[model samples]
Target: MSYKILAVNPGSTSTKIAVYEDEKELFSESIVHSDEELKKYQKVTDEFDMRKETILNSMNKHGVKEKDLSAVVGRGGQLVNIHAGGYLVTQDMKEKLVDASTIEHASNLGALIADAIAAPLGIPSYIYDAVGSDEMKDIAKITGMPEIVRESFCHVLNSKAMARKVAAKAGKSYQEMNFIVAHLGGGISVSAHERGRIVDAIPSDGGPFSPERSGSIPLNYIVDMCYSGKYCKREMTKKITGMGGIKAYLGTSSCLEVEKMIEAGNTQAKEIFEAEAYQIAKGIGELSPVLKGKIDAIILTGGVAHSKMLTDWITDYVSFIAPVVVMPGENELESLAAGALRILKGEEQADPYKK
Candidate 1:
């Protein structure tokens, strides 16, 4: 049986919507929201209705009716940690998405909006490979300091999707392959895929620096900076996750712009760009032990993977672990669509979202 599935992914500045018939995508649209436009909303959740309306407008423009949909799947938001795969949105899930105590992210709006759209039609709303998916082994959670334990908060959606893609290309089951996946975009996430499970990962905020994120800085200096009081709490947070890394050094987040400057003989741009790639390779190498040095493949993906110069720098460092497979761009929309189709086709079961 064929199913019309709508996949919605909410980013920091855009809502990406896609309609699919099983594995085939019918239409996709990225509804971008400028900073100036989003400033009106006090919180990310406040834009729920606005984003939903935008999605409806796009769907209407594309001639896709709500009643025609079989299932709606969204990018999992800031829910509690759970295993990988599709989850049916229940009342519990909705409450958690809107909980004030939990972290607020644009993706959290995905399930809320999906539920609203699917409820009236009595169709199921599901979330797949949410940002909060946690599957690390117990030992992996331990940090040198007992007070702070490591959390699994990397690009689980894109990393797992690319892992499955490369595994298929190699004629091997994802559950049987040991792979290292580096998702380098505005942020970077390097993880080890032990078979189908992600055993360990260096999340964007805690790993190598990216185009805009200041991955891991020295602990003592960070503490000293915090005490120095040059920045407030919010500004300090932004420094680590949003305005740091190459953006801090070059004053722009676009890798292409940085590359252009590098081509024009900008020594600072050239060195900073190479340093980002070097750090990415270092993060990938750190995961070698997680897979016991028997990695089947090293997969490079996400937006920055499109840069041959950057990917080459990373490949040069980690090619010894396994064959480097470059799978540029994020496949999150397809992954969400496939997860819904899997449940609809009885190939996979949708798990309940428990608080």
Candidate 2:
């Protein structure tokens, strides 16, 4: 029996919703929220009602009926670290998402909005492959400093989806192969997927610098700058995440613009762009040992992976380790839908959310 599924993925300024009839998409829409409209909300959770209403209205406009939806799936948000898969949205999960003490991210609203819409219909609402999916071994969490330990925080949803896609194309199950997946976009994360689980990863902040993030920096330099009295804690944080990398050097976050500059004979732009690629290849190489050099493939994905020039450069460096498959774009909506479909078809079980 075919099941109709609704997938909700909330971003910083938009809520992306899609309807899928089994595996085929019926309709999808991105409900963008302007800065002026979003300013009224003190926290990301406060925009819940508005996002949910817009999603429902979009569904109605698209000729989708609420009663026909077999299940609702949402992009999982930041919660206590859990293994990868679909989880039934529970009150325990919702509470953690809205808890002021936890980190505030736009993604935190995904499950909340989905639950609000699905609960009334008496249908299951699930969060799939949450951003905080942490399955790293304890040994992988070690750091040089005893005060710090690495945590798993990468683009789990898209990364896992791409991995599974590659596995299927190779006529093998995900659990039968190992992969090193790099998600390159505004932020970048390189993970070592051993068999089915992510055994280790270089989270966005600790990996190569991306369009906006500074990635890993020298600890000595960071400490010196922190106490330099040049910037406050928040400002420093912004410098590392929001205003660093390509934007810091070239005054723009767009890789396309940098490519344009290269074509226009800007030597600095070319150098910086190459440097980013160099760092990415290095990051991929770092994960090779984790998989013990037995990787089946190295997959490059996410928005920035669309650039042939960038992907080509990275391939040149790391192609020796394994074949580089360039699969661009973050297919997040489809990933959510597929996860829900798997649960609905009894191909996989939906894990319960626990605090």
Worst 10 residues of 1 by lDDT: 77-86
Query: Candidate 1: lDDT over CA atoms?
Result: 0.91
RMSD to the native, candidate 2?
Answer: 0.9
What would the TM-scores of all predictions be? 0.98, 0.98
lDDT (Cα, tens digit) per residue for candidate 2, span 1-355 = 8899999999999999999999899999988999999999998888988999999899999999999999999988887578899899999989988898778988998899889889999999999999888899999999998998888989999999999999999999999999999999999999999989998999888979999999999889999999999999999999899999999999999999999999999999999999999999999999999988999999999999988999999999999999999999999999999999999999999988988
Clashes of 2: 0
lDDT of 1 by residue, 226-321 (tens): 999698989999999789999999999999999899999999999999999889999998989988899999999998899998999999998988
Regions more than 4 Å wrong, model 1: none
Candidate 2 error regions (>4 Å): none
In model 1, residue pairs whose N, Cα or C atoms come closer than 3 Å (at least 3 residues apart or on different chains), thus clashing, are: none
